[model samples]
Target: MLTCVTRGLFIQLVFDCRRLRKMQPQQPGYSSSRAYLELIADLPWQKVSEERELDLRAAKESLDRDHYGLTKVKQRIIEYLAVRKLKPDARGPVLCFVGPPGVGKTSLATSIAKALNRKFIRISLGGVKDEADIRGHRRTYIGSMPGRLIDGLKRVSVNNPVMLLDEIDKTGSDVRGDPASALLEVLDPEQNKTFNDHYLNVPFDLSKVVFVATANRMQPIPPALLDRMEVIELPGYTPEEKLKIAMKHLLPRVLEQHGLSSAYLQIPEAVVKLIIERYTREAGVRNLERNLAALARAAAVKVAELDSTLRLGKEMQPITTTLLDSRLADGGEVEMEVIPMGQDISNTYENPSPMIVDEAMLEKVLGPPRFDDREAADRVSSPGVSVGLVWTSFGGEVQFVEATAMAGKGDLHLTGQLGDVIKESAQLALTWVRARSADLNLSPTSDINILESRDIHIHFPAGAVPKDGPSAGVTLVTSLVSLFSNRKVRADTAMTGEMTLRGLVLPVGGVKDKVLAAHRYGIKRVILPERNLKDLAEIPAPILAGIEILLVKRIEEVLGHAFENGFPLRLHSSL
Candidate 1:
């Protein structure tokens, strides 16, 4: 019991109720505020830290030693972290790696975790549907767990941890805002400072957490959510890079895991390359790792099964091409007589050659190339069809641009899921061609005139897939010019650039991807805007060694060179 409101200077010193602790009712029927305060005090309060690193030097070393060939990707990562170091106030950059699966999105995330001393958590959202998956449920829901972001923090017991949100683009919107939208608060550097946890009932600063997101596509991302994050594209590994990664990391790990350790488990670089090119088709090493796992398991089982059949030796030996070839025909028709791999063998009794593999073995194992060397040439050549080199996260590919002018009502039609940017690009190309038609020795018919008299439609193939980006300008214009002028651009050449109505060609991005696409398509020559020549510095010397790169400032220069027969490009009034 306490008396609180009393005159103090009147020499009436009474018990100060404000200074007295609230007493828990000792009576039989007791209900008190003390019970509620006890519950609140007992609630778990976790201590957290925002910026923690494992070991920056070690992370860099691990990346260099673990993977091969993606020098650009590793370099980009360093630059990203460097920016973070420069601005410690900013949370670690939100990285969105756009690339084909298996190139090492998940692996690199782990490496980054180990490099930094902070805890690391990886969550896959490939098919996540519930917004509650990201934003925690209200405490009213029974047995509801905290959303991924909060749970990650509590488990790590730190404010800052590397939380890899895999496949953020796949995060969908439903009755509740998309899980991606929930990321708005957590990922936003401004609002995350007061990130309130429903259960904790206290605002916890979350700006310290480092968030990284990965996806195979960028188009699906909501603009509002995407604006808050930094996107880092992880490029696919080249064949050489794949082979080296296998030899350096995958093969040894598989062999050790399968109990075929030591030098005896050696897989030759050539065979590893063969496995990568034939058995796997991805930007990353996941496929190659799985294939290697299969091979290692198979080798272990084979050796175990063959133990009593043949005399054993104390020393383990590497499985040569001979043994690998023999295993390929293990349960097949070639069982009757072993096919020898190496050249030259003779015996008096028509000795069957022992099963061994060489270049010729590519056919038996992979069942002929999925594609042929002359596949490009085998395609039927059409009047306005032209090959365009375009780059994707999967590296580069040769894209075909087919222009067809059909007999229809006077109208301009375009199809093939072209995005706004690309659609605008096609229109620009058309305007450029119409203005310079006379110079290329073709009728200069504007779209308005053409629609009034004749109908024309242009399309980029592969309709099921959405296509955008503005690097297709030159391809469209060249195809149209070739069709009207009745000429053919070199079958082995590809071009990519943006064109203007005034006939002045402007530079576009994806120069490296375009060049790579050309190389992949067996094109000997490529045409890019002269301005993009600076981007060529990113190109590896080995990849671009034999290819011819032609930089053009004007569409007219491309006209004479791209077409088979040289025609003086008509000087447009604007030109």
Candidate 2:
């Protein structure tokens, strides 16, 4: 009975194809029908890539060779491979790499494909708003076609290729439809086994294909879609890590691309350090890589000029004494012979001396340093200016909050593209300060009310950019305290934490990123909530060694470290 049913379905498909083929070119459905048949024929229904035998050791080595210092991420990849090796048919969770740009997420995906010995395909979903992008447009549509997944498979000519959904989080919902919603079926293991596309109108098995995804952030991705994949957090690289990557991976690649070698262009480790610090302030080595590439390009041009000079000089050598001398003596033109290919150009002018990159060369090629370590110190020089650490999409940043007092109704004025939570935090900071004005000794005279006498205005610099989050709570209080007491917060110190009206400091998120940001800006001291001490364990030892981390249970402890003189708040009540 099953055989009869299968035969009937096969005969019906063949009959439909024949009828479509016999249709005339002027027929209403000829073009669409032809396209539909072409798509069906082109899809890799039975064709699959022959995967290599999995070797955990080799895979690890390949990952290390291509990327530098992602120990945990590499471990996760290895574990996934090991499972596949033990049971080739095992259903494993999809890997979703979440990190800032240029952290090698896409490259890591490529490396995985190489390790698995499968064809690789990348489907960019950066701005895909239409659901038809993930699931094909219906055949009833005039210009319908297969979705990105099926089309990618057809292009790679394999069903089991490693497919990367690049920039998955960038997909958004609209009147057309949500690409992310369509992706739900594509990424889910149970459902994806029989994934359906509207144009194909047939179930395709995606179980054999290895799917990997990359995103700049996790929050933008829908929770249902995010839950299907194993999330791996790739944090920003430290200066040391970037340095090693520049030397080991980026430098060699850049030199090769620009047609130069180390002998032609020598970039010392110290110069690379300067490039990392002075020119580029980023969470990833992307901009650093660009700077290095620029240096290489400059060196390439110089090398080419030197080569030309040597060639001309070498070609002239054979005629310098005889032909050119006689010609010049007679006031006649002299022509130099061209050096033929395969000649010993090595004998030509001793391989024009290598150009070593120095401070001057950096300034010449990349222009003046874009960032300075002294920015924090210079900004926090006056009272009411306090350095606060905040994490943004780009990673951690040192935000300087400035507060000043003016004679007006005692309302708080906030600026710098602040959000509601931060605005509330500012209000909370003001109320707390006013409530404890006696202990803080806000005014020299006891009879006068500071709140009634002055209005406070606070501004976060970089007004063009948006800033928010409750982590600024502690920093807001510090800025207000500095304003009322006329004392300057220590220029070398930065703090991040939430605060309560009761003056207790609460822990916040992104502790590691914040500390890294402080270190990036040359801050020697960092004040974090005492509860966030455990987060310090995740920070690299070298970073911690350079900066002093002070933990505070109360906001007063932050004030103690933030100022040269401890803020002595004498409590008068035992509530």
TM-score for model 2? 0.90
C-alpha local distance difference test of each model: 0.67, 0.87
Candidate 2 residue lDDT tens string, 104-173: 9999999989988999999999999999998999989888888989899889988898899999989988
Off by over 4 Å in 1: 1-44, 47-56, 69-92, 95-100, 127-130, 154-159, 217-227, 254-267, 271-357, 393-395, 444-459, 565-567, 571-575
TM-score of each: 0.73, 0.90
- Give residue 464's lDDT in candidate 1 (0 to 100): 77
Candidate topping lDDT: 2
lDDT of 1 by residue, 1-575 (tens): 01211245112212222212444457421232333233223322344444554345666677888666667777777766666666766555677777767777777777666665568888888777777876666655555455677666656666567788888877777786677767788788889887765543345567766778888777788898888877776665656667777777887888888877543344567876667655665556786798677666655665555543343442448556876687677854443576776745433224133223344544444455454336455542656877786665555667788887767775668899888998888888777766555555575543234434667788777787667787788788888887887676678777888777766678876666667556545678888889988988877787678688889987777776687765565444445
The TM-score leader among the candidates is 2
Candidate 2: Cα lDDT at 519 = 83
